[model samples]
Structure formats: structure tokens, C-alpha cells
Target: MLEISPAIKNLEKEDIADNLLHYVYNTKHLLSLIKKGIDLDDPSYLSSYRSFEGEVYENFIYEKLLRYAEENDYITKFVLKGFHQGKCKAYANTLSISEKEQIVYRTKSREISEFDAMFLTKNNELYFVEMTLVKSVLKLRRRLRKKKALLEIIFPNYTIKSLIILNEGATGAKQFPSYCKVWFTKEFSAAEVLEYITKLDKQKLLPKDKINSKKMIEAHMLKLHPFRYYNTMSWITKTIRANKKYVIDMNFLMTEKVQRYHDLYNKFYVGFLTVKEMKNILHLKEGEYSEEQRVVVALEKKHSDEIVVTYYIQTTRKNLYLYSFNDAKVVKEKKDPYGITVTEVFHINKLMNESYLLSISQVNTIKKLLKERFKRESQKPNEK
Candidate 1:
């Protein structure tokens, strides 16, 4: 007897089953046969094996599981690789919780196990699942318990439930122990699974005290990891701490660092510096600074000249300020004529320094000012 979901009737009316089967037999079969070196062109060869076609049939079954779960209101997410050990695998999986942390768990060291699926309810209760195409109820129950133990270790805070779904006639559903639930073809429908999960009242599942404790732990973990504020924020923190004994001004340090970076970054400049040298010049402590940020700054310089030309750029809610030396007053000021007018060019560099001089045009302007100053002084004596 063919065991099918009542929802399968809905799918049948639309000829979705025929289309799905067609997809299954053609692309799925051809790919599987090609792997085994079976003669696909021979009609007799195709006729002899009219039923199962190995992994291809397994893939089609997984797809059907996904379609059934989605149609029945389970929100599904899949992890094809990196999330588990062994060869890469696909999971037609579902999660029911809204917790900020990962509810599903898998370890790479467990060689025999390919993947583990988890469904968490809003109340902090969870179901740990291990699926097998094998029809044996005994084998399924054993594997399901193993998965539950693994998840208990991974998610210590949440209560764990266990479930196993196996092929029909593999074992009687009664074989499963009372503590665990076994779903056979006739007893459990995709709709029932979806309804059971969706109807779970999260408020009842998650106690306020547990949620609060989880939140506190999460907050402390975030502080340790510390979200990347600026690209160089980590470097800044480490460098500042390493030299904490010295009275260092952040603004002054940033200005000098940004200017030095600009000089090294601009390849056309006379004092071209390598990334290693730039790191040392910035007074960076060990691996505090990332080469990634420096590479990005270098690439920006490669594409445009504007980034290398600016200095001491700062932004407020309303406006931006560029600091440069005014030879006329012999002092640095908040505004300079050569400063960038457009706000979009704003960027942070770790090498902008006092010793850094402007480009050739800026140099000429200062020399011209000095010449005029000398001329004014000479005329004053003549007038006297």
C-alpha cells in the first residue's frame, strides 16, 4: 500500500506529483546512473530497474519532505555544508523557536552521524531529530536518543524531546518507548507535525527566569567578542591598552596614524612605505591591527587620488572638519581651503600626522605667501 499524506491529495489535484515524479526520474535518475556507469541509452536497462534508483530516489524523497513541511506551515531552513562534519549534505529541516542563539546543534567529530535536525518551540522547549530512510524502528529510536544526548550538551538550558521518522512497515510505532514519540506513515501526517509545532504556546515553554539568565550570558559574551565598531577599532583598543601607562591623546594618535598611513598608501609619493612598516609606524601592538583594513585603504588609493590628498577629516552631526597647517598664522586650524567639500569622501585613516606635509600645490601656496610677506616687509621700510 502506498502511504501518502492527505495533503498529497491536494498536491495530486494540481498534477504536482506527476511533475515532481518527472523531475525525479529524469534529472535525478540520469545523474545517479552516470555515477554508477550504467548504460542509460538502453531501454531494457531502464525497464529492468523500474523502482528505486539509489541516492537519486533519496534526494527526491528529501525534496518531497521539504515541500510537505512548507505547505503545512513549518518555517524551514537548510544548511548544506560547514554546519556538519563528513561529506557535505542537505537537510530539509525546520526550526520553531525565536531565540537569538542557535538552537540546532551538530559536531564535526562524530564520524558515523551525518547531520542532526532540531525544532525549538518559542517556550524554550526543543525536539532533537535524527532521520534515517531505514525502516527499522529499533535503529531509529537508538539514533534519535543519541542525537538528543548530543543536543543536550550543545543546548544545556533547553528541555529536549526526541522523534524518529522511518519508512512504513519498518517497525510498529508501538515499539518506541513511552518517553519518545515515533511517527509512522499512518499515525503522523505532515499537517499534524506542523500543527503540533505551530500551536505550541511559547509563553508557557519559556520561563521568564531562564530567558533573563540567557540574555545576561549573551550580553557578557557580546562584550568579550565586542562588535567591530570601526575596522580598526580592535587595533585601537589593543594599541591603547599596550601603551596605557603613557598619557596618550586619542585624537592626536589617530591624526598621526592616519597621516602616516596616507603617505605609505600613496604609491606615487616619495616616502612609499610597506604595510609592515606602516603597522610598526602606527605603534600597533602585535596583531592588534588587521591587514584587511590596510589593504582596503590601499585599494581605495589605487582607484582614486582624493583619499591620499585629504587630512585630519572629522565629522559631526551637522558638518565635517578638515585640519591642516596654516603657515600664515603658523598654527593648525579646523578649516582649510584645500579640505574636501563633499561629505561622501569621509574615511578614517590611522596615519594622519602633524609632520605630514601637503602636496606640491599646497607647498607652492605657502611659498607664495612667504614671498608676499617679505615684499610687504620691504615696502614698509621704504615707506618709512
Candidate 2:
């Protein structure tokens, strides 16, 4: 079994009110919960899922990998459900039991569950991923071997590259048994996994030959419970979105004067803005954002021509990912999250939905709205 650090374990414990507060600290779980309507305000809803800290780490890596892939077009296209853009579709924190790729276990009487993360390149190659957060090298290595065999059996026609992402923080050498590359989360950002997969895609690493019968492979996956992607998603989404800034690390996000604007009108991958420039697009006079908590802006073609700005707090994250897209050749501006300064922008398109910095509101209304909305939606059924 995978083990979690005490700090991570505390994330799934009861809150000050003794309400079951879990999954609210995970990003993958947050998105899944919102999409599934799993209420966080009620403790009864929490009893339906298990609270393993390793799942939190898996969810973070899962979402970040997909985000990185989308921004760089690593997989060409993606979906939360089924395949849409031909052969190049990536699924985040979802199962593999779909009609496209599923293995039935007659002996165990079940089907293979969802993977920590999975991706198919435009070239029809597969990157089967299993993320682990543990301190036992023996257990970690054993899990990697098992996951690899299962992936190959299910995807016999394609070239498979099975990878294990190990999250470690020690300042010492972390060794892998040559099965796959070992990543130190303390040293590298989760998004960097996309770049590694891209390299593997170009080189075309083939999976070790396997001839396991379909029934045998299915039995193994079903019995081992090799991967999961559901209940964990519902719990974590509530956690991360609940306090996005606190739940998320500083690596993938950054804040500036125009974060809400960039977030609202994110056309380009990266862009720049000044309060003065947005005056034209928003039709607001100077010092309009002086109060800081709220503002307004015009949209080119969206829900509305003009939109209101709401304020919110987030511990999971508190920054915007603004990238400038040049078709396939994209360049992004990034910064190391260890400092107080914002990263430099390498590319920008002012004509696109030119963003502007809104004055900061010395209020927490945005935060409350976010909490209430999540609970309110989670309580509702997902319907048309």
C-alpha cells in the first residue's frame, strides 16, 4: 500500500466543525465533484469514498499533465468523456473501461478500473501512467511492474510506454530499478511530465513484449485494483477549489494586475495588460478599479458582451495561466513559484482580448461565493 506524509494525511481529516473535510484539497477531485454534483457541506456525502492521501497526489499530477498537454498540443486533442478528435484524445482522472479500451476479467468477475492518467498521441501511441506517493522503494518498484504488465495486456496493438511518477522530497539520490524514469516532485513541476512524454513519443519507445491472455490480464487488474479515478475526483475538487491557493502549490500559477481579465478572456496562451489599456475594452474611466473587489469588462463573443468581476480566495492556487498560441509552435512565459515576483512574459498579443489588471478588493466575497456555489451545485443533479 502507498503511504502519505502526515501533512498530507491531515488534509483528509475532520475540520474545526468536525465535518468530514476531504477531497477539498485535491484538484482532480474538485473538477470531478463539480461535474458530478457531490456535495461537500454534508458529512454523509463524505462516507461514500475512501480518504487516501496518495489519491490527492495522483489527482494533482493527473490534471497538470492534461493541462500541459493541451497548452502544448502534445496529444492534439482531449476529452473528459469519450474520444472526440480522432486518435489523439487524453483523459484525465478517468477510467479505461470505456468501449475504446477496456478489459473484462472473467476469473475475477470484473473490469479494469481507470488509470491515474492515460494519453494517446496523434501517432496512436500510448502513455499509460500510474502515480505513487510513498516512502517504500520495494513497494513502489513492485507496483510499477504490475501496472506495466496490465497496460500492455490491454493495449496489445499499440506501442506502450508505462511510466511511474514517484513524488519524493528528500535532497538525496532517488533510484529507480531501470523500469522507468523516476521524477522528484520536489525538484520538478508536475507539468514537466508532458515534456517527457513528448520526448518518448518522438522516439517511439515500445513496451516489453507481452503475451498475457485477455482473461488473465483482466483478472490481475480487477484483483489488484491497479488504478482509480472517480470518488477521489469528487472529494479532491472540493478541497482544491475550496481553498485553491492553499491546496495548490505556487509552481503552476502566477498572479498579476490583470489575472481576472486574463482568466475571463483567455484567448491566447499568454498576454499582457495594464489598467489603462483595458479602459478601451471595458469602457470604464480611470480609477474605476480603485475599490479593488469588483470590476467589469466587455467580451468579443461569449456569454455576454460585458462581464462582472467577482473576488475570491484560493489556497490551492491564485494565479492565471496566460499563454500566446502560435498555432502548433507555441511559446509560454513561466516563473519559478518560490518568489514574490511574477514571471516574465516571452510572448503576448495585445489585440486579442487585451487584458487589464483590476484593483484588488479588500474583501472575501469572492471566496464565499465560491464555497456556496460548489456546495449548491454538488447538491444538484447533473441534468440538461
Candidate 3:
């Protein structure tokens, strides 16, 4: 008798099992086949075994998602409804909590489509995930749109969310549906992906007036490993104390030292800012700043506070822009010993600059600083 996991029993009929078998067969003689004239590394071979590779990749993603749904606290809120490889029939049998079907079929279009994985929460939100190893999203766009339409028709009441997980970074990512979130496995780990999917976006931050200095400082001091505000401040202060001859404004010194530390250690200085500071950085008059203000205001309104606005300054030659993100969904908000409300972690959902305002030259003197930093970084010796 063959044993199947209760969680994945419903998926046994899907192509994941077939994909695994194919993967094993392909991998078994892969080395010998490579030595014998078949160059698996060649792009030409993609058509032959790429399906197996893709299926295996999809299975890997499904497993990771399954693990998260079982183990992670944040992911626990979501229940893995089912996994379907290509096509499946709509089942009347409903999960204990919700009466919704995991898969849907349309008789008019006569199309049987399904996402690689699907999840649901008690609140009637549906998450559909697709995994691909392809480098471009062009071919996948039509299928995604079709699947979106199918799901919308079946689950009209639920808020449907789509996630596309790519084996690596791809081109034409912008071409995907605006509502869809794309993640590159090469850029993000399974844990990071889980954190993103289950992040808390509905939690509103305390209003700016209600926010205290301690809360503000805590937001700014949000760590990015190896570097934090206090650590940078201490280093700059000690260096200044030792060298009384070097004179610089405290604000200027902090900026210079932060950049210096980043260049030296290849670590980014991750910090948070308020909407007011962001507007002040642009330093535009009412009419002039209106466009940027809209982006900032919309983001601030989503989180209901500027405490969620996070930015990281990277001084490395490769990283050019001052990347920032808003809509940082917090895990939990609680009062600390000081009676100040604080968030444990700010899991960023989207990089604002990619789709919004941070790239503008006038914002934070980006254009001037980009040139200066690039020139300075170019002059340095290769990092050890």
C-alpha cells in the first residue's frame, strides 16, 4: 500500500506527482546524458525537459507554502485549501470553515484552469499562487488573466489575490496584472515569501499627534542587521571625539558616517521616515509637491501613519537608488515598558519607488547624490 500525506492527498491526482516522477527520471541520467552529447545547459534543451523542471519547481514552492501554513504563526491565519497543477473539477465538498469550492470550472468557455496553489482565510479572502521558471512573463499573462476571470466568477464575494512566484528574476514583471504580486525566488527566501503573503495591512498606526518621540525613534531605529541608528551614531561620535580637528554639522556627519559605514561594510542603513519629513526632503511648494504628496499621502493613509514608511540607503556601486517602501504591514502592535505603542516588525509589501515617486530627481536630492555617490564609490578599491 502506498501512503500519501493527508494534506497533499487531494493533490495526488494533480501533475505534481507526475512532475516529480519526471524530475527523478530526468535527473537520474542527467550527468551521463550531459557527458554523452546532450547538453542540458543549452537553451535548446529547455523545450524538452523544462516542463519537468517547471513542475518540480512548482512542487517545491507548494511544499514551502505548505510548510509555512503549518509552522509559521503569520501563515497560520491562512489554510491551504488545495493544490491543482492544471485542471480540476469543482467539488461540492467544502472545508469545515468555508463552503467555497477550491477549484472552479466554467461550462460556457469549456476551460478548466487552476492555479498551482490556493489558500483561504476565515475572512473570505482567497489567495491564488502560480510558480514559473521562465524568464519572461509574456506567455503567462494571458493565462493569469483567464484564471483571474474564472476565480472572480466563482467567488464573487471573496477578495481574490494573485501571487506569481518565479524561479528567478524575470523581465516584463510590470506586464502582470496590477493586482498581482510577483516574487523572484532568487531574490527572496521561502520565509520572506511567507512573511509577505501573510503580512498585516489592516492594522492602522497611531495618529501622528498621538505618536510619541519614543515610538517615532523606534520606527526610525528599525534594524537591518549589523547597522542601526544608535550603532552608527556611536561610531560617528567616538570618531569625532577622537579627532577634534575634523569639524562637521551633526546632521551632515551622520549622513557621511552612515555612507562611510555602508561603503566599508557593504551594509545598508535601513530607517523609517514620516510623511512630513518625506515632503520636507522634496522641499516643494504646495502645487509643486502635489504629485509626490499624492503618492506619500496615499501610502500614509493605507498604513494610517508615516511610521510604516521605510527606506534603505545603499552606497554600493551596483545599488544606485535610495530604495524605500511603504505599506509595511506590522506583525503585532503592542505597548512597550514606556507605555508607547510599537510594532514588532514591519514586513514591507511593495517597493514604492518601483511603482511610485521616490525615483524623482528632486526628492531627497537623488540626482545630485546619485552622481556624487557613484563617483565616490567608483574611486574606492574593490571590497575585500
Candidate 4:
């Protein structure tokens, strides 16, 4: 199954399965922003970013990489000489996750495993990329080195650029493998790279040997045998501890994180007000058990003070007000965690009109169901 929790390694571990369900939803918000060409730098995007697996960073890097590849000669069509003067052919790894799809090394008989991305140059050169958001650079290096070897064997005719795009502060070493290069995202710019990739096509390029005349060769050797490098992310982490800001600011992360959840909560909260609509607020699927589970979660959120939600009768509107005082939590009561203007009268009239049609008995029934759902949520018997 696809990993729903961000904590797992390649969806191989189910340790954090209990925290599933949100990852799918969170990615939706981030994807929407990316489509709008929104600069991926603000506290809203950055703070909420860490909770995801490498896939989030991978997608971010994909945009930059794709942009870079297109502007450069990497994406030329298959010409008689195999396009772009036979220089490059780079694209994302488009394969199904359920099957065993890989290139195998005939010598070692080892598989060139799934890649986050790929770049093939007409020089018959291959650039295999590994994108990561994980904090452990030690683990990342190990994984990438193995991948580097497998990829080289897979594309025997091609020279390989074993590249890993690490998030800032992921790698501490001033020196690393000349062959296996690590790019810290903050230090690189997709826009700048795209602009230059075009111009680079016009500029004459040097051979690989020239880049590895000195310590670069040693770094390449170290990557080939990554086990020798003990000085990794550990040193960077220690330095980060001294200057606290080197890490993500906790205040920004927490404030923005909760606000993100609030937006999701209110997405269902504000528009629908009535026993019927509110009762099914937590209902992610269709079924009595699922509906009951939703009630339990909703009640839990309310009781824990994570949200200030309540139900009241709207005399003029002619329905129950399943209300949340979320405006109080935001500054100036601008948005109700949902990014919706809290006091906007345009939505006010529509929101007021779009209420549930509930009889008093139905209301009472739903309220009793909530109590029962809350009881079941506690996993205690018959108390409700």
C-alpha cells in the first residue's frame, strides 16, 4: 500500500500508520500553491513542509529539474543523432509502484532500483537523481552511493552524474564526492539554473577528467566507498544546535501548522450548519461505523479545545448553527483557518442560507448519536 504517513522510508515501514490519513490531504494544498506559481518560500509553505516524506521535496525539485531540462539541451527529441545534438534526455521516473520495474547489473546481478528522477545527455551520459527531505544525511549518503553504483552499471554506455538534492542543512561536509554531488536547495535556484542551462548550451563544456584533477577525484573515490565517511550530517546538526535559527523556527512551524489544520477543519465547518450536515462532518466515507468514527473525532477535537465548535439554533436562518469560534485564534479575525475571510459579508449571506433542514427530533437524534460516537471513540463500553 502507498505510505500515508510521512515518517516511513519509501513506504516500507508502517511504524507511523496511526498518523496516516492527513498526508494525502496536505499534499493537495501544496500542489494547489505550486500550480499558481506561488514562490515556495513563505512560512506557510516552509513550516508545513517537514511533515511530509521526500515526495514533497521530490515534486518541488521536479519542477526545477523539469524547467532546467527543457530550457537546456536535455529534452531534445530523438533525432537521427538522438536529438539536442545527442546531448541529453532527462525526465521523471514514470513507473508503477506495485511492480518490480528496474534495470539489473549483469556483473553484480544487483538491481538499479526505482529512481526519483532521471537525466540522459546525448554524450550518452546519464544523470540519476535522488531527492530527499530526510534529516539523516548519513542514511541518505548510504542509500545514494548504492544507487550510484547500480545506476552506473545499468547505463554502462553513459557517464553518470550521481546527484542527490538535499534540503538545506542536510549535509555538513565542505568536501564531498566529485562524482556523487549533493546540492543543497537553498544554495541553488531553479530559475537561475533554467536561465543558465539555456546559455550553457552555447558555452563550450570541459570533459569530466578536468573536473576531477585534484581532491575531486578523491571525493569521487569516497562516494564509491561511502562507508569510509564518518564526518556527515552529525557535524552540521551540532552546529545547528548552537545557532537555533539554523533549524526551522518552532514558532512559525507550530502557528502555521495548526492554522493549516484549522483551515481543513473549517472547510467543512463554515459552509454547512445543521444537525445533518454537522453530524456527518467527520464522515470521510459512507457507512454508519465511519459516520460514528467521524463523530468521535469531531467531539475529540472539541473536547480537547483544539477547536471551539458548538451548535446553536439560528432563528432567522431557520436551522442549527454548527459554529466554530475560529476567528478568535487568528490575528484581526482575518481568516478562519480556512483562508476564508472571517467577516466577509458576501459569503455571510450564502453561508447563512445554506443550512441544514432539520426537525427538532432529528436534531436530538444526531446529538445523541454524537454522545454515542464519543463513547465509542473512547473505546469504553455503554457509557454514552
lDDT of 3 by residue, 255-349 (tens): 64343432222222122333344454433245532232222211110111111222332222122222234233322122232210011111121
**1 versus 3: better lDDT goes to:** 3
lDDT of 4 at 140: 56
Q: C-alpha displacement of 55 in model 1, angstroms?
A: 4.0
Give me the overall lDDT of model 4.
0.36
> Global lDDT of each model?
0.34, 0.34, 0.39, 0.36
Off by over 4 Å in 4: 1-53, 74-112, 173-175, 187-384
Cα error, candidate 1, residue 99 (Å)? 27
Please give, for residues 1-384, the per-residue lDDT of candidate 1 as tens digits. Answer: 113465432222232232222221233453355457878566744543333332223333334433443343332222221111123232112211112122232212112123333343445554544444444456555455445543443355766675455455665567565545554432222332223333546223221111111111111111111112222332443343234333222233335443333232221111112234434333335764344322111111222112221222233422433322333322223443333221222333333232222334443443354345445645664431
Model 4 vs truth, CA RMSD: 22.3
**Candidate 2 off by > 4 Å:** 1-51, 76-108, 111-114, 122-124, 170-179, 187-384
Instruction: Please report the TM-score between candidate 3 and the true structure.
Output: 0.34
RMSD of candidate 1 to the truth, in angstroms, is: 25.6
